[model samples]
Target: MSTEKEENQVKSKKRVSDHGEVFTNKREVNAMLDLVKQETERVDSRFLEPACGTGNFLVEILERKLIVVEARYKKSQLEYERNAITAISSIYGVDILEDNVIACRDRLLGIFTKYYINHYKKGFNEQFLKSTQFILSKNIIWGDALTMKTIYGMPITFSEWSAVNGSMLKRRDFQLDKLLENLEFDNSEINLFSDNKEPVFIPQPVAEFPLTHFLKIGEYE
Candidate 1:
C-alpha cells in the first residue's frame, strides 16, 4: 500500500513537470534565503512558484515561514511542533496541473494535521479545512507568466487606485513625465515596469493593512 501511494505521487509530479514547471533547486534557495536575511526584510508568507511541480518550492517556503514564526515566539523544536497549525496556514502554493494542485494542498494539510495532534493530542477537525483559505483558485493559476500581462481572476478597482487629492487628477502626484499622456489614468493597478516587455509583480507587506480582508472606510475611522 505504501509503494502504491509512492508511485501515484511520482506520476502526479510528472503531470506538473510536463507543463514546463521548474521547481527551484535547494542550493539556489539556500543562497536566496541567506541574501534575504542579510537584507533584513519582513518577507510575506505569500510565495508564488511559477513552475511549482509537486510543490517543492512551497515545502521550502513552509519551512522558512515556520522558522520565522518560531523566531517571533522564541520557541524550541518542541514548542514549534506544538504550534504547527498557525504556522502551516501562512505558507501557500500554486500549481498548474490538477493532480499537482491536489498533492500540494494535501501535503500542506498533512503538515497542519500533525501539528493538531501535537497540540491537542488528537486528529484533525473537519471545520479546520473549511477555515483555511490558503489555496485559492486565483492563487494557483494555469497561465504562462511571460504572456500573461495582468492577473485576470482578481479585478482592480478604483479604490485600489489612490492619489494625493487632485494631484493625481492633474498628473502631478506621481511625476508622470516619463509615461505617455495617453497612458495616464486616475485609477489602475499601478504597474511598476509599464514599458518593459516582462512586468514584475512584487507583493508588499503593509503593517496597518490586514491580510487581504475587506475594510470598510468608515469602520476604521
Candidate 2:
C-alpha cells in the first residue's frame, strides 16, 4: 500500500498520465523560487499558481514570507499574526482535481498553524484560526484554468484581500478572465514601455466589503 505521504504527493505516474499532474521537486522548487526571492519574502506580494498541484510553489512562498514576518514582527504577536494572515491571503492557487485542491488547502493551513504554535505558545485563538482558514478557502480554489470556470461550472472569481488602516480588512472580487485580459500588454506601439503610460488593466471590483476584522468575512453572508 502506498504510504500516506506517497498517496498525497502530486508525482504519481498514473496521476501524471491521467491529469498531466507533475509536481516540482524541492530542489527545482527552491531554484525557481529563489529567482523571485525578493517578492516571495514580501508579505503582501500577490502570487497565483494556476496549476498549483498540492501547493508546491505556494508552500515555499508562504514559508519565505513567514520568515520575513518573524524577523520583523516577532516582538508584537498581534502584528505578526495579522501580517502572517496577509501573507496567506496573498497566495492564490487553482487545480482542476478536487483532491489536489483539498490537499493543497490543508497543507498550507498546516504550515501556517505550525508557525503560529511555535511563536504564540500560550493561547489558542480559535477566531484567528477560523479567519485564516476562511482566507485560504477564498485564496486556493478548485477550478479549470483553461475554461476559466470553477468545478461547479461558474465563472472563477478571486477575492483580493487587504488589511487597510490596521485591523480593518477589505475584500474586492474580480472575474478571472477580466483580470487576465487586463494584465496583457496592449498591442498599440505608442505607449510600449512608456514611463508615463497609463495602467493597462485596472480590475474593476465586482463586489466590495468593509469588514471590522478578517474573521467577520464568514459572517457577511
Candidate 3:
C-alpha cells in the first residue's frame, strides 16, 4: 500500500471510530463545541476528551475557557492567566496513537508555556517537566481512552478501581491523611519520594494479543 494509506491507517487506528475523518473538520466541530461551551461555567471546570484525536476539541475548549476567564476577571490578569493554565491542567485526554498523543500534548503545553511565560512573573515551575510528570502525562494520556485500564492492556473494572484506589482507604494509622505523605505504597516508602500523595503505577500481566473487550461483571447487589 501507499505511504498515504499506511499513514491514514496508523492514525485511524488511534481514532475512536471509522468516522474519524469527518471528526477532524475544524469548522464543523468548533461550531458544536461553541454551542456546548455556552451552557457551562468556565471557572475551574474540568473536562475530559477521552479520545483526543489531533486535539481539536481540547484547543477549542481552552480557547473558550480563556475568553471566559479573561472577561470575568479583568483586573487580575494574573488570576486569569493562572486560571487558564489551571484550567488546562483540568482537561484530560487519551489517544491510542503515539504520534497523535504527543502532538496533542505538545500543543496544549505550548499554549500554557506561552501564556505563563508572557503574562506572569511567577511563571511555571522551572522543572515542571521533570518534577511533575502529571504536567505531561496527566493532561494527555497515551492509551485506550475507552478502557480506562492500566498499561497492562486489560480493561479496568470498578473492582480494579476499588482495589487500587481503595488501597488508600485501608490505612488508618496516619490520620487518614498521611497516606499521601510519601511514606509510600506498593512496597516503597514515602521517604524515597518525599511525598506520599503522589501516584504510583502497579505492574500487571502483558498482552500477547490486544484484549479489546473489558472484564465484564454483574450488577452489584
Candidate 4:
C-alpha cells in the first residue's frame, strides 16, 4: 500500500559505485525491524547502525519509540520530554560520509520535533530541543565503523545517557573500538564471567560528566 519511489533508494549512481550507498526502502526497513519489534518500541533500548545512510532504519525506530512515549506519557509534558530524550539518546548511527551523518541527525531531530509539536505546540521547550540536538551530535557519528575511528582518525566515542533521580541525566563516554573488543571477547569460548557466573563485559568509560538536568544537558557539553 506504500507508494515510495524507487529512485529515493539511491542518491546517485556515483554514490552507489563510490560508497555502495543504496538505502533500504521503508517497506524492507520495516520488515527487517519487525524481527525485533519489542526492542524498537522500548524507548531506552540502544541501536547502532554502522552504515546508516540517511537513517532509514534509525528514523523508523525513533518513530516507533516515540509512539510508545506519547501513548504512555503524553499527559505530562515533563514526562513526555524525558522519555522522548531517552528515545533519541538511545539511537546511534555511524556513516563514513559527512553529508549522510548530518542528514541522519536532522531527520531524527525532525521526527522528534514533529511529535513534540503535535502534543505541546506553543508550549514546546527550546531547552529540550537543544538537549536532543546535543545528544544527536554525540550519538550519530561521522566515522568509519570498520576502523572504529572518526574522519579525523580519532577513536569514535559514544555517550551513554542515563536518567537519574527522575529529571537528571548522567553521561558516560566509551570508545567504539574498546566496546566492540570487549563484546567479541565476551562471546568467545574464553568468555569473561562475573561473580555470579553470568557473562559480563564491563567497559571502562573514557569520560564521565556530572549529573545534569535532562533539559540542561546541552549546557553541560
Candidate 5:
C-alpha cells in the first residue's frame, strides 16, 4: 500500500477503536443517499443524520435541494434565498465528536454560500448569510445520540423552520427524544372509551422564534 493509504488506514483503525468512527467512502455515500434521492431533492423535506461524521449525507442532500431551489427561484432573489434557507434549516445532524460537528456545519454552510454567490453577482447578503449560519448552528448539533443530550448535557433540541404566509418563517422547537419517541401506539388494541382512536403525537415547541424575513432572525434578540 502507498504510504498515505497506510497512514489513513492506521488513523481509521484508531478512530474506530476510540469512537466507533468509520468514514463512508463517496461511492457508498451516494449509493445510500440514492435510496432517498427524491426526498433529498425536496427543498423542505426534513432529514436527520444521527451519526453525521463530517456530513457525508447532509452535504449531498443540501446540494440536491439547492439545485431545485436554483431552478425554481433563480429569477426571484428573495424567493430563492428564503427557500434556500428553509432547505438548510431542514437538515439536522448529531455527532459525538466536537470536531466532526464543527466540520459538518462549515461544510454545509460553504456549499450553500458558494451556490448563493454563483447565482447572485451582487456578491452576498450579509443578513442572509448570518441567518443561514445561525440556522446551521441550531440544526447541526454536537451530542451523543444514544443519550439524546447535547454536548452541554442539556436535552438535544431542534428547530423546524417553515416558510409561511409568503414572507414569514415559522420556527418550532422540539426535544430530540420527544420527537423520536412519537408516543408509541398499540394498533392491536382499541380503546372504546377514548374519543381519539389512536395516541396522537403533536410536537409542542419548547421555544419558538418567528421571522418576518430571513434577515429578521438576526434582529430578534
Candidate 6:
C-alpha cells in the first residue's frame, strides 16, 4: 500500500551521486531496530549513527525511549524531565552534510518537544527545553565520521553527560579518535581490570567540567 513518492527514500539524484545519500524508509528502519528492541526501549541506552541522514533512525530510537520514560515517570514532572533528558542525551548522530546534520537535530528536537508538550502543555519547564537543546548541539555532530574530525578540521570531541546526585550532571569531553583507540587493542588482552575483575579499556577524557544542575547546564560553557 505504499507508492514510490510516499517512500521518499532519496532526496535527490544529485545528492545520491555527490554523497551517496540514501535514506532508509520507515518500514526498513523499524525492522532493523526490532533486532535490538530492548536497547531501543531502554531510556538510557546509547546509540550512535555515524552516517545518520535526517535522523530517520535516531528519531525512532528517541520515540521508543520516551514512551518508556512517559509510562514510568509521567506523574512527576521532575522525574519525567530527568529521564527524558537521559533518553535524549544517550542518542547521538554524525552526518557529513551540514544540511543533513541540521535537519537531524531539528527532527529529534521536534519529536522530544511534541511528547513533552502533549503531556505537560503549559506546565512544561523552559529550562528543561534549553538543556535538551544544549545536549543535542553536542551529541549531534556536523563532521566526517570517517576522519573523526569536525568540518573545521579539529578533532571531534563528544561530551559524556552523566547524571550525578539526581539533579546534577557531570560532563566529560572525549575525543572521537581516542574513544575508538580501544578497538586497536585485542579483546583477549587484559590491559586493565575493573572492580569485578572484568577486562575494561577506559579512555581518558580530554576535558571535565564542574557538576552543574541539569536544568542550568546550558548556562555553562
- Maximum-lDDT candidate: 4
Ten contiguous residues minimizing lDDT sum, candidate 1: 167-176
Report the CA-based lDDT of candidate 1 relative to the real structure: 0.41
Clashing pairs for model 2 are none
Task: Candidate 3: list runs displaced more than 4 Å.
Answer: 1-22, 39-41, 73-78, 121-133, 154-221
**lDDT tens digits by residue: candidate 6, 89-137:** 9888888899999999999999999999999997978888899999999
Clashes of 2: 0
For residues 114-206, write the lDDT of model 1, one tens digit per residue: 444554454334444433323232243443334332235422110111222311211111111222124434343433223222333322211
lDDT of 4 by residue, 40-80 (tens): 89888888899998999999999999999999999999999
- Superposing all C-alpha atoms, what RMSD in Å does each candidate have to the true structure? 11.1, 4.8, 14.7, 5.6, 5.7, 5.1
Tell me the tens digit of each residue's lDDT in model 3 across 155-191. 4211111111211111001111121233334544222
Question: Residue 80 error for model 4, in Å?
Answer: 0.4
State the lDDT of candidate 5 residue by residue for 1-221, as single tens digits.
56998998897898899889977888898899899788778887778899999999899889999999999999989889889988898898999999999999999999999999998968468889888888888889999899999989999988777788776787778888876664655565332112235654545669977455777765654
In model 3, the Cα lDDT at residue 111 comes to 64
Backbone clashes (count) for model 4 = 0
Q: In angstroms, how far off is 92's CA in candidate 2? A: 0.2
lDDT of 3: 0.48
Clashes per candidate (backbone, < 3 Å): 0, 0, 9, 0, 0, 0
Q: Which residue pairs does candidate 1 place in steric collision?
A: none
Error of 6 at 127 (Å): 0.8
Clashing pairs for predicted structure model 5, backbone only = none
Estimate the TM-score for candidate 3: 0.53
For model 4, the stretches where C-alpha displacement exceeds 4 angstroms are 1-11, 182-198
Off by over 4 Å in 5: 1-11, 182-200
Measured with C-alpha atoms, the lDDT of residue 44 in candidate 1 is 31
